[model samples]
Target: MQTILSVSELSKTYDSRFQALKRINLDIRRGEIFALLGPNGAGKTTLISIICGIVKASEGSVRVDGHDIVADYRAARAMIGLVPQELTTDAFESVWATVSFSRGLFGKPANPAHIEKVLRDLSLWEKKDNKIITLSGGMKRRLLIAKALSHEPEILFLDEPTAGVDVNLRRDMWQLVRSLQASGVTIILTTHYIDEAEEMADRIGVISKGELILVDDKAELMRKLGKKQMTLQLQTPLPLLPPALAAYQLELASDGNELIYTFDAQGERTGIVALLEDLNDAGIVFKDLHTTQSSLEDIFVSLMKEAK
Candidate 1:
């Protein structure tokens, strides 16, 4: 895949000597949905701001589609569209007028056809003539997206785009993102929603304490770090785990009615057979059993723990 955006050793520091972002390097593949995951106060927003030219970096360089962000500021910025985290809009302006004005900001000639398409795609066409103040929270969110797409940017940066949105709106926005990806738009989203990243991203990056700690293909990351657990419903309750089964490190739950064992999913030997055999030797019987794999949220939590 071709690289659409590149960052090299990017860092940010405030005048008060606070370091917001450490040395970081990243490359975004063209037409891929990349999710940046982190907790609050993480460098996710700062990194996005630097790339979008909203904030200047203390060091390092960023390139948008081979154009240096600093030296080729206009061209680099023109290739990107940002749906900010805040809902800053002209209160008195009509939806249609606001969206059109955004396009004009990029020096794009008036193209009502494109504007109409963007509005329709966002489900905001019917409210195009309505004032921004009269729209609901969800409608305003959609309007922000419409404004971003008005210039027909190649890459779109969504900063918590679905925050505070209703579930239905989130689903609709997911569908719209899929359609945009299908149209060859590279997407980079900053989200605290782990499921959002799990569902939409081809790749995932984790940032913590001003550093990019990990980045990997989503499936691959889960496979490498994910855990699997098995629960056995014991027919007979045991007062304590026998010495013979002590090596399994099993947990007693449901008042000793359930035996829980966790192990690596990718391990060559999960030791399930050994555990069951040991259970039989210990005179324990199991009526039923089930297994489950760790979710992306689990991985994120574990990573955060390790980083701390």
Candidate 2:
């Protein structure tokens, strides 16, 4: 894969002497969906702002498609489109006009066909003549995406794209993202929704307290850090865990109707066979059993804690 964007030793410090980012370095592969995950004030937005030329970096550099974001601002910015977290648009302008104006901002010629295609893809064609103010919150978000695509950018930045969106609409946006990736557009996603990252990102980058903490493939991250748990439904409820089961450190659940055992999913051995044999010896019978792997949210929370 080709490196479409690169950040090297990036840092940011406001006039208040507060640092918003610190020695951040990242490389985004062309045509790959990269998810940026972090808590509030973790510098996700700052990094994106610098890359998009909205904010200046105090030190270091960023190159978008081999053009330096600072020295070659116009060429670099031309290759990227940003859907900001805020809903900032011309309230009095119609949807069509707003999207058209955005394309013009990037020095793109008037291409009504392309504009119409983007609007239709975002399900906004019916609302093209409507004023921005007449649109709902969800519709406004869609308009932002339409504007971002109006310029036909090679790299798209979606910052909290589905925030406050309904379940159905969120899934619709997910489908749209997939189609965008299929069309060879590199996507950079920043979201509070860990599930969105888990579902959409090819690689996950976690930042915290102005630092780039970790970056890895989504599956590899979960497999290496995720835990798995097995729950057995006992044929007969017990008052509590027996003393003989102390070594397993199992937990009694469902008012003693179930027993839960947790272990690393990637461990060499889970000890399930030994535990089952011991259960048979102790006359503990289970009618059924099931297992579950830890979710991305669990791993994200633990990472935040460790960073703290």
lDDT of each: 0.94, 0.95
Task: Give me the overall lDDT of model 1.
Answer: 0.94
Q: Give the best candidate by lDDT.
A: 2
Query: How do all models score by TM-score?
Result: 0.94, 0.91
The per-residue C-alpha lDDT of model 2 at residue 249 equals 90
Q: Report the C-alpha displacement of residue 130, candidate 1, in angstroms.
A: 1.2
Question: What local lDDT does model 2 show for residue 195?
Answer: 97
Candidate 2 to truth, TM: 0.91
* Weakest lDDT window of 10 consecutive positions for candidate 1: 237-246
Which residue pairs clash within candidate 1? none
lDDT of 2: 0.95
| lDDT of each residue in 134-229, candidate 2, tens digit only | 999999999999999999999999999999999999999999999999999999999999999999999999999899999999989999888899
Which stretches of model 1 miss by more than 4 angstroms? 243-247, 267-269
Q: C-alpha displacement of 297 in model 1, angstroms? A: 1.5
Candidate 1 per-residue C-alpha lDDT over 102-158 given as tens digits, one digit per residue, 9 for 90 to 100 = 999987999999999999999899999999999999999999999999999999999
